[model samples]
Target: MIKIPGEKLIWMYKTMLKIRHFEDKIHRLFLEGNMPGTIHLYQGQEAVAAGVCANLERSDVITSTHRPHGHALAKGVAIKSLMAELFARSTGCCGGKGGSMHVGDPDVGMIPAIAIVGGGIPVATGIALAFKFQKSKRVAVSFFGDGACNEGSFHESLNMGAIWNLPVIYVCENNLYGASTSIRVAVKIRDLAERASSYGIPGVVVDGNEAISVYQATSKAVERARGGQGPTLIECKTYRRGGHSRSDACNYRDKEEEKMWLTRDPVVILRERLTKDGILTPEDSKQMEKEIEEELTQAIHFAENSPWPKPEEALEQVWA
Candidate 1:
């Protein structure tokens, strides 16, 4: 197992916690009719975002999917801005133009997440293309669900990255089901990573619930990309604790399948490893959670007190 730095481990812990609490608040707010629009919570898949982001520099770019709260938080977007956006407030990161699924902060190198399935793949490839063309060392990373692997853009983007040796990392968070359809039934290939072979780039599978494993996998891929070694496809085998969106009950899933994944909860796995390895104490973990909860409370208050976007302003940002 790769040894993560103490500071980096703590940062990853905080990032994951922020994601967890942010989404939890969103779930509550949506339930109470305080929020509009659908939400794709990133509750169970926090570690993948934290781990991959921990390996990236401020200059490196990341593209996110519909389920992007975790990625946005891990990429350094402000909690206040995120909550405001969720509430459709004018002070949001995108000035309320982008809502829950589109949360992002360009100052931190993240574009508004592409809510469309597999939409980020080509955009990330384009960002990498620009960096490659400019001879910049920055790498672009894309976060997409397993369903995205079957999309046409996935193949086209990977081929473009390989053919040009562009600096990109394609991450498939294989949470088994793509909005109710299981990967077993959706794709012919057993591993999503195997598809990278067709593009002549490296691909591998990792325990997405394990932050250390994900960090290590992403570090190497980032390094390879920075060296102009082209792209890598990483299939993170994980599970989503929540349903596809606010309305989904996940009735299509099996009880046994849900039970099995609940045992592999990423936060629990990380906390255990931290305690067992003498990196953190149980009290420390609890303290961290409380601190995060307090911050989230403040974020909600900030968002609630903020003003909603003005109706007339909508036409201002519209393009012909």
Candidate 2:
């Protein structure tokens, strides 16, 4: 276990809570028909983004998948701008161009998310190539789901990354199901990290629910990549407690399985550990939650009051 400082742990806790509350609010907004566009919520897998991003610098860039808000938040994107993006306001990070699935901010080093499955793999690889050519220590991270592993781009990008020793970290946020389909039905092998061996790169499997473990694994990977060693494939074993999309009811999931992952809720797990280890008291946790609620409230208010993009300006940001 990486011995994270008490203050850092609390900050991680806050990030996880922020992600949870953000998703919770989004879910309600979608249900109430106030929000436009569909969302792939990142409720239960907050720790993966929180932990991995904690190891990255602002100069480090990350390309996110369709389910990207957690990564955006963890990478230091402003909540107000993110909420505005979700609400389709012109004051958004992408000027209201990239909606829910495409939420991100260049100022924060998170590229506009690629909603297509496995699409960001090549883009991230290109970024690594850029970093290498510039001889910069900066790294690029690709955040994808289990489903992307099956894509051809995953293998090609990994092979190229390995051969060139690019400073790229491929993070697989395995939340059991790739949308509504389970991983078992997709890949015969159990451990997604094992695929790294074929590409001659280091692969690691970590408890995505445990922030410390994730931090340790990513820290090592980042160090190696910065040294011009190579890329790393970190598959974080996690589970999402909700449906894959806005309309999914998760009827395909087993009740017992859902219960198991719910018990392993990253936020709750970290909160318990923080309190039990004498790092935080119950009161302290509650205070943190209270603060996060205020932040969420303000973000939502900002989004609601933000301006919308003009109809004619839509084509301005688009490529001709």
Question: Which candidate leads the pack in lDDT?
Answer: 2
What is candidate 2's lDDT per residue for 59-136, written digit by digit as tens? Answer: 899999999999999999999999999899999888887889898887779999999999999899999999999999
Q: Estimate the lDDT of model 1.
A: 0.91
Model 1: CA > 4 A from native: none
Model 1 TM-score, all chains together: 0.97
Candidate 2 regions off by >4 Å? Answer: none
Reference-based lDDT, residue 26, model 2: 88
Residue-wise lDDT of candidate 1 within 28-109, one digit each (tens)? 9999998988889898999999999999988889999999999999999999999999999998988887999998988998
Whole-model lDDT values for every prediction? 0.91, 0.92
